[model samples]
Target chain A: MGLIPRTIHDIDTPAAVVDLDLVRRNIQALQTYLDGTPVHIRPHVKTHKTPQIALMQIAAGAPGVTSAKVGEAEAMVAGGVHDVLIANQVVGPAKISRLCALAQNARITVAVDDARNVQDLSAAAVAAGVTIGVVVEIEVGMKRCGVAAGAPAVTLAQTVAAAPGLDLVGLMGYEGHTVAIEDHAERAAAARGALGRVIETKALCEAAGLNIREVTGGGTNTFDITSKIDGWTELQCGTYATMDAGFRPHSGHMFESAFWILASVISRPATDRVVLDAGRKAVSFEPGGTPIIEDPSGLEIESLSEEHAKVSLTSQNPDLQPGQKVRITPWHGCTTFNLHDTVYVVQDDEVVDVWSIAGRGKFT
Target chain B: MGLIPRTIHDIDTPAAVVDLDLVRRNIQALQTYLDGTPVHIRPHVKTHKTPQIALMQIAAGAPGVTSAKVGEAEAMVAGGVHDVLIANQVVGPAKISRLCALAQNARITVAVDDARNVQDLSAAAVAAGVTIGVVVEIEVGMKRCGVAAGAPAVTLAQTVAAAPGLDLVGLMGYEGHTVAIEDHAERAAAARGALGRVIETKALCEAAGLNIREVTGGGTNTFDITSKIDGWTELQCGTYATMDAGFRPHSGHMFESAFWILASVISRPATDRVVLDAGRKAVSFEPGGTPIIEDPSGLEIESLSEEHAKVSLTSQNPDLQPGQKVRITPWHGCTTFNLHDTVYVVQDDEVVDVWSIAGRGKFT
Candidate 1:
């Protein structure tokens, strides 16, 4: 290519620009925080969705990468990641076949809460002649997707252990409802209370003649608390690598925000208002946490259409005109990263490289 | 090479499925409504983002397609459409160059609200030796992007007329603020009042000796009111082809909802709770209008995680179990279509064809 833009100004507008230094710092910070603990780091690939960054996280002491879908796990394997843990349910015949196909090349582990789903996984694994690891997900408090954390969890683990071509690896329970509590002591108490059932379930499974080797839990918001809970073997923190506005209020001191959406001011309709080219489609409008302009001047995003952000200037005469560039911090990094196909890697405001978000739109 | 799935049961989960018969009927309904009136339809392709669907709308009776970005316009031109309108501001040098490149083989028109952008467009048009059409977008009431609707619009029209290699084609102003008012009389009154400024600006431009031939406004919610209003030439009602839950409250009886997200029940955590494979990533979670399950048997979406929709059964046990499929209607079709790469075209629940969402991520 013809000399890819060396500086951020030469790059196109509405582009996902990533700070490489901050990304490395964020990864290093998480690894450093869990250095003295027994918990291993298995960074979630859902936030960045780029395989290169997953590799970087793996290089920085992450045991493997955690994916939210089977398609994401497949992409990680194709990009040279040896071990993958799909942290969600992989349902239906097509996805089960796809999940089984990935086990032929590398270590593929999936979380399941239903006995029927576990049976289907066993059948697919036997048909494909490959072994797939199973992690029984326990419903701690999130109440989204997990079996109840008691005899139910123990029974599922027993069924997984009895299935053919399947290896019962561990137990998983995410304290999602208590992750972003915003108070350190309150968050600690909530995490401990939610994860107590997980520890109990692990003990129950072990007491029933089962070897539960791992117990995984933790979000980026509660990684510090969950890492110290004595039983969680790994922290599946995804947004730590690319901090967002939503989670930054609670975890700002630990990890630096590295991702930004670079947009151009396209319309200065009035003296007090200037509209940017980025809107809900470019950034995300997550509830209770909308994106903000990085200038920190008296500028505020009033509303968003499909393709434009109507920003009002609280300061008098900001000198913003058409074609002027501004950086925006997205509310939710995972959803915002899903909107773009590529991100420009930057260091010190200079373009370093370009990476494709290979795992985006991998909903199936 | 292999036989495609003939029925919806064989298709993959978390897929965007479009009913071809409903889509054509919606298109025909809108076309029939505007037949006796003098207003022509220029459907916005931002909702579906498929070139094949845009071609279908053109076949029904559309002079051109309206796009929200330059990249979408480029895709339309490459997909055998000769007339395209970039309905939003296209800033920066790279996009301007790309817009001019498309004018080499098609009639390219764009909306502008700033003089600096007009100068840049004129310079780029001259450099590329192509004439571009310009539409001065007036700020009716949306407060997003456009010039003030009186003398300011007239002045911008003058500047556009003086700019070489640019043709002052028409005037555009979207009454987005009042389109979904939910009351027929109130919507009609609001549409008339907002579009009144557009007609006034056109008259003022004509008084100033500018050939303002076209005046465009209206969303799908106020298409009927806008078509009956005097001095309007076209309507840009996009969601009429694929009605969404957000706009269906006001316009449901006129157009049928044509899109559905087919997802599999992946988790049955409790007797009253069943989680689907589709979540915010598969469907949209737009504020004030989140998606709903198509089954009317007392099913409700409680919350959404990244990859799972926590749905609750309002009544006693509804027979939804793991591996069973359900259809979902999205809150907003435009944002929902942006998440998929391809849509499976279905007719009577049979797979008829597959069309790529060619303009899904054309933010620039």
Candidate 2:
């Protein structure tokens, strides 16, 4: 309805704005961290869900990109990504067929935990006449998905290798339980034990005559630790690119928060209380944590309604009035990005371009 | 991707399903309850956010649809809604101009708690050559957005009357503080006190020579109590059509949960644990509450990650395996509906139709 906004100030409130300079710096920082290291960065596209941003990560030294859903893989491939590793289980015939369709154009790999799921993928891939890559997801204390690390993982990988039109590509172990530990020493010990299981399981699979090429693992919190491990071929650090308030404590030393919801103070009901136009719809708080105000340091998010965020002044009240803009660092960048249709790419307060969050609502 | 799913089992996992028969029953129940009452229903579209559903509510008996944002109003008008009331403040020039533009198509009314916002609306309306309806929102126990009752509310009404290109439509008092009181008598007492404040303020505004009409209030939880209150012109009850688990505890006698996420069991790592494909991205938690498994009676949602819902066996394990469907009732329908692109309108296990949740991601 309006001209392409040339600056952040011109853009409307409750908009997802990503700093291109900061995003590039974030991409460069991960590349620098894994410079001489054997591990390569397979940036997770679920963070921004913008194929353009995923392509940016691939251009900066990443051999491929990581996706959590089949739709994301399709988007990444459509945006010109040749290689993609879906870090989660792609179950059901609908998604498996989608992956097979995508594999015809790009190198598509999915993590599998169950034998039936592997058989489903193999059948779909064979029917589509495309050889799909499969990674045995080893359980690393997350307890959400994946098979047990030792014999169970080897059995699943062997199934994938034996199935028609399927290639046993690699193994993946996500230490999701250790990613959020605040203490560095404690987190390092937890991640080492989890990754150690994956490394040992890879040896077991190799002994069983299964060829394991890529051993993918690691999140933003365990990137440094997993990179130090010997067998991890790709580090899947999602939140590192566009960091959030929850990951800032763990990854702030490496990357800065680039993704934020630019909201306008719509009401100043009390001296201590201010309401912004953005709320649970704009900024998420479940998976990651509570979002924090980055620009106005004095304001803290008290609570959020369906459409209004109630903020309170933690320090001295900053004479905020209605129509004043407030920059909020989302608690979880992935889910927050899922709420918006587009991300306004900004550089030093100037809106350079707009990229559609094409993977949003793609939870097919 | 596949043939338009003919049945619920043929539909993909992590899909939002709404039973249309239940929706029609809920709409009829609400209309029947207030058949002899003075107040008319102005259903809030924030729950479903579908213009189709909003139009359905209008067809049932609602005078107009209540929206929380300007973009929702636009979607409603596009869906054939002739009248809409945004029950929240419309601040800043960007949203003000949008409201002015929307006013030209539909009978648009917006709630205001500040003089500056009213001025902005007036200026934009004058520039756009549209007569925008303004309602002075009164703080009725909900400490989010609204002016104080009595004199302060009267003063704001007077300011709206004096503003050029604006019509002082009425007043709004949302008793959000008392909606979720578990006890009926206690909730009735609270709703009475809050509605009494709005009634007194309406009288005060009338004494100040302000022509006030259309005093709006009420939610799904407080609909019965708010309906009994005198002097309320419209009851803005949302979430009644497609109810959720969160409101079922209070409103179960009147409405059933029509909204749910049809997810597939992806993992069963333990004897007591079952993981579904739907998680935080597909179902919200903060604003609403945790989603519950409805069909499989023995399961209770333990926790949710970004893409998995971990459920625990409370009574006995149902022997759920991978690829089995589970119906999950979202804790809050409003926030959960915002997560999906389309809703599978089902009836008697058949996928009768698919409706787009048009107002989703329209948080501007």
The DockQ figures for the candidates are: 0.81, 0.69
lDDT of candidate 2 over B1-364, digit per residue (tens): 4678999989998999999899999999999999888988999999999988887888888989999999889988988999999999888777887888898888999999998888888888999999988888988877888898989899889999999999999999898899999999999999999889889999898888899888998999999889888788899999999998888889747898898999999877666677888988898876446788998777788898888899876445688888899999998888889999989999998999999898997888
Model 2 C-alpha lDDT per residue in residues A175-240, reported as the tens digit of each score? 989998999999999999988999999999999998999999899998888899987788988899
True contacts recovered per prediction: 0.78, 0.69
Predicted candidate 1 versus true structure: per-residue lDDT over A243-281, tens digit per residue: 998898888578888999998899889888889988888
Q: Please estimate how well model 1 matches the true structure, expressed as its whole-model Cα lDDT.
A: 0.89
User: For model 2, what is the C-alpha lDDT against the true structure?
Assistant: 0.88
TM-score against native, each model = 0.98, 0.98
Q: Which stretches of candidate 2 lie over 4 Å from their true place?
A: A313-315, B313-315
Report how far residue A280 has shifted in candidate 1, in Å: 0.9
Q: Which residue ranges in model 1 land beyond 4 Å of their true spot? A: A1-3, B1-3, B314-317
Q: Please give the lDDT score at residue A307 for candidate 2.
A: 90
Q: For this target, which candidate reaches the highest lDDT against the unseen true structure?
A: 1
Residue A55, model 1: Cα distance from true site in angstroms = 0.3
